[model samples]
Target: MRLFSLTILLAAVTALAGCNFKSVPEPQVSARDAEWLAQVPKAEEDIRYARYLMDDETGETPGTIVVDTKQRFLYYVLPDRKMIRYGVTVGDEAYGWTGTSRVARKAEWPNWNPPAEMKARWPHVHPMQGGPANPLGARALYLYEGNKDTLYRIHGTNEPEKIGLAVSSGCIRMRNIDVIDLYNRVDLNAKVIVR
Candidate 1:
């Protein structure tokens, strides 16, 4: 009887030790987020939008990002006159912007707070928490002119079907996998020229 009681105590102690008392509770996911997640397609990219390494025609220095809205491509200049090109989705004609800006910051799986203009345009728009369903996809490079944020981002998109199209409000959108690759390569405050 004494040995059995000791064995039971040992088992109880082992079970208690395996439990995590300080673990944080998971946040509740909203219905909208669930709906968005359901829409995520497989990560297959179209041949036209596939990443390619090609000659740098923009003549920008190494580590510069050149965005050609007309062709719907973003080029990351490399050393030795080489560039990595990735197809992207640019703003529609009425919402397009062209200027030189710096990547002020970057985020992985970033939470999205719709800009005032965007909110006004779409009354149903709401802030979304970061996750697989988030429209910002896997990464984001925030654009800024000096210290002021232009509210523009080069970010991953959930809608891979929109690549190589002019459809966003004024942001540059890339496939999630492509943006993840770009985010890993680019540094903060890198030069970005959108034309």
Candidate 2:
């Protein structure tokens, strides 16, 4: 009887091992978006997406966006203490601003309007229409404090190579594909915490 039971258990384990489970498919990138992505350099392996386990240390409630500027990571808190983390580029020290805010509004392929200060610094500054080639690569989540626009953004970037650096003026920059993924997962008015 013991030998018969052992044989059945082994068969079950072997069958389970042979079973193939499919994973979720990646989001489809449009032809225009694909062409644009082909132009930008690939991000380093360290900056790639990963699942992180969250604990009480992550004070914010679920669905909050926590931007770790020092670590160059953005965490979108999910249910059951799991988070989807993406590598990001934060603003350089001179242009960096840290505070709590909310996603006031969102836009797809948002236009690039150089602020007056940026234009003053570089007279060549000009607004660029929204498209694959635009600086705001594929999406923009406008951050706001109360009803006022903070003029800072968490948006996709044309430069994928900048994903793990501090180079933006003040906006949090994400890779086009990563930003699009985040754009889909987060809701308008979601809490954003920068640290």
On residues 1-195, what C-alpha lDDT tens digit does candidate 1 reach at each position?
999999988987676456421211222434754455456776556655677777778999999999999999999898998888899999999899999999999997799999999999999989998877778876799999999999999998988889999999989999776787788789899999999
lDDT of 2 by residue, 1-195 (tens): 999999988987676446431122345777876776777666564513332333324667888999999988888887876666778889999999899999989988899998898889889979999876678888899999999999999998877777888999989998787788888889989999999
TM-score of each: 0.79, 0.79
Model 1 spans with C-alpha error above 4 angstroms = 1-39
Clashes of each: 0, 0
Report the number of the highest-lDDT candidate. Answer: 1
lDDT of each: 0.84, 0.80
lDDT of 2 at 48: 32
Off by over 4 Å in 2: 1-25, 39-57
